[model samples]
Target: MRLFDKEKGLFISGPEKQISCASQIWMILAGVTDRETGINIIEALDHCPDAEGMSSPYMYHHRIQALIDLGLKDRAYREMHEYWGGMVNRGTDTFWELYNPQNPDESPYGGIVIHSFCHAWSCTPAYFLRKYYY
Candidate 1:
């Protein structure tokens, strides 16, 4: 794989490959390389199938939010549909707790503790898109 470093940040690419859960989360927020070629974010999730299944709702929600920021409403809405559809198939209750979160009174942890690496990488586009696009 080839890695590129620019003022924006670091990016890696090549024939499809697996990245650590930490790195995958980073790339998502950082935005995939060569978006013009239509590198779908969904493709990256394949590397973390368990995370995908466990956190699909959050991931999809973030993607939709990112799409909206990119002014890709059509794509965002389509993803929303797919997300809800997947929830229907997978059973919404199975993942609802992660979204709702819980207090100590309710549970030991409050909501899912998604790593900071995941947050920074997953949300990077919303923060740096103008640098790359505008």
Candidate 2:
């Protein structure tokens, strides 16, 4: 039973499966797989936008970080704005609210939670830009 064999038995599956695969591929290309792959995962991510909806901030953050890593500060800034903008339009105040725990056994916190998240989300790019580009 080979891992990553798409035709195998039971395996993980979902709408974001493609993005997960891409992340693994990117990691491999980034030399995390071996001592000689010597590939830039960040550049690879910058070239691929199909993984934009994986529901993982770390993944999305990495994509933006990759853009920055590749010296595309302006593009990264733009992408960050677009990303948070979409989240905002969806009524989520912050990215965390989209995934944060609401109560001890439920979903998001709602209301101020959304607003707080949005504020933080909106500030991220500006913070990054000021810290790295300015």
Candidate 3:
């Protein structure tokens, strides 16, 4: 399985050469590398200069799981609390399909009308917290 970039110090997708948080998180989930290496890859992703960032709750969930797998439970839990709590504080009864704190109104579609406020995928923070932290 192809993994990281020796030069950029992050995971890279083949063919397109695009580096993404999803690729790195999936590699960690697959258990194909050492824990130290996985943590390094995750740290690299945290500090990566990539403009894509995390585009979906699906991707963020993976990143949180990766952090937990790497024994960064506090970091993972803190992220979960902050991320989901932010949504809760904003008056959301259910987790959103996508949430970007920097842009509260951000949407994958052309407008906010198409956004899913109660996405199933976005409900995993409770599971992560219960499984790993609580």
Candidate 4:
């Protein structure tokens, strides 16, 4: 309850004071939130037009897995298309540690060049493709 922001309709990192898909993912993974509430959280997040969103592919990877666990395959696919495919559409041969379609210069580390442009954290697609798609 302390972590969930009722006003925003998602879980958050208290100190950061931002709605966190990561927190919702961890809550679902750790069984802190029940199945129904997990679904509600996901739905609420979808409707939360102003939520900042997962900062990078690293955080988004867990979000994909969490969506899979919750049986939201279509939602997971759409999220992948939106995040990872956003990079693909840009002709990036490799996935990035940080990315923002609206602003390529955006970076949590203060500069775009400071992070991994081709990161290992983005390699889990094969796992999902094999286990879930195949």
Residue 92 accuracy (lDDT) in model 1: 38
Provide the lDDT at 53 for model 3. 77
Query: 53-112 in candidate 2: lDDT tens per residue?
Result: 344344556556655655667877777777666666667555643322222122334444
> What order do you get sorting by lDDT, best first?
3, 4, 2, 1
Q: Write the per-residue lDDT of candidate 1 for residues 1-134, one digit (tens) a residue.
A: 35532321323344543333344434555655345322344344444344313243455555555565545666666655554544345453333323212121232254345422123233333433444344
lDDT of 4 by residue, 58-90 (tens): 778888888888888888878777888888888
As a whole number from 0 to 100, the lDDT of residue 98 in candidate 4 is 83
Look at candidate 1 and give me any clashing residue pairs.
Answer: 29-121, 29-122, 29-124
In candidate 4, the residue pairs with backbone N, CA or C atoms under 3 Å apart (3 or more residues apart, or in different chains) clash, namely none
The predicted structure with the larger lDDT, 1 or 2, is 2
Q: Compared with the true structure, what per-residue lDDT tens digits does model 3 show for residues 1-134?
A: 35568777677876978887777788889996789988888777778787257756788898898888889988888888888888999998899888888787887688878898899999778788678767
lDDT of 2 at 93: 52
Model 3 alpha-carbon drift over 4 Å, by segment: 1-3
- Candidate achieving the largest TM-score: 3
Top-lDDT structure, candidate number: 3
Number of clashing pairs, model 1?
3
Report residue 57 deviation for candidate 2 (angstroms).
Answer: 2.2
